[model samples]
Target: MPAADALPIPVGAIVALFLAAFPIFWCAILWLIAGMGWRRLANAYPANSDPPDSADRIRFATLALGASVRSANYSGSINAWLAPSGLWLRPILPFRPFHAMVFIPWAHVRSVASERRMLMKLVRVALGGDVPDLVLSGRLAQAVLDRTKAKKR
Candidate 1:
């Protein structure tokens, strides 16, 4: 009996195969994200704001150097600047064109609460319905609350 020869692999066939498999690859990625649970991104950075006042003494978050920040549509924390106007949450990584700075105006913040999760207390800032909430360490949270409260006074 003659040995069977390998079938010729055509470029067109290979392209067609990839085209068929691409949707499956995309679906698998979506499925994985959904299975892991989808958390909405938060935009903690605000837009076009005044510079920090020398006399007012803004409270910058030292701990925010590597903190994870989120808004309604963003993930990962950026450095924060607490001015009398509001809290400016900007990307820790520099000059990200797409990443936005979220400015949570003192008026926009509905409340700040401390909750225990993962055996740690986190300060949760509720930014009303227009934005997602922010969770920070208790100390930083207190700092935010103080700044916002001071603004009201």
Candidate 2:
């Protein structure tokens, strides 16, 4: 009895498969972002214009979305800007698809509270209306609160 030879996959076939799957993957990401409440937030506070030059930029920040305890955690992929007018948030380039940049004004921030979770100090900022609260690191949250207080004065 003779053994049959194995056929290798062509490089063109692999590239074609990836090309075909790209759009489907992108759509799935859009759906996931919507599920994470990003779509709702974007509708409420879309960033039509660019953030000001004076805004303080914070990279590799963490964020929590949704109202439930089992919310979506975007760890170390968020780029936040603390401007006098409001807080600007957007995901990094790779995760930016279907996630629009949003600007939540200081007035919308109802309250800011700090809490210790495990070893990390977390700050939760409650916003008005139906949007989810934003959870950030303690230091960053303090900066946001300070900015709001300064704006008031």
Pairs in steric clash, model 2: none
lDDT per residue as tens, model 1, 29-146: 5444322212222333446654465423223343222123322222333466666666666544432334455555677777876677688666677755534456666446667767
* TM accuracy, model 1: 0.50
What are the runs in model 1 whose C-alpha is more than 4 Å off?
Answer: 1-46, 53-77, 94-97, 148-153
Clashes counted in candidate 2 amount to 0
The global Cα lDDT (0 to 1) of model 2 is: 0.80
Cα RMSD, each candidate: 9.0, 2.8
lDDT (Cα atoms) of all candidates against the true structure:
0.52, 0.80
Q: Which candidate number maximizes lDDT?
A: 2
Candidate 1 RMSD to the correct structure: 9.0
Poorest lDDT segment (10 consecutive residues) of candidate 1: 33-42
* Candidate 1: residue 92 lDDT (0-100): 47
lDDT accuracy of residue 19 in candidate 2: 100
- What lDDT does candidate 2 reach at residue 92? 86
Clashes (N, CA, C under 3 Å) per candidate: 18, 0
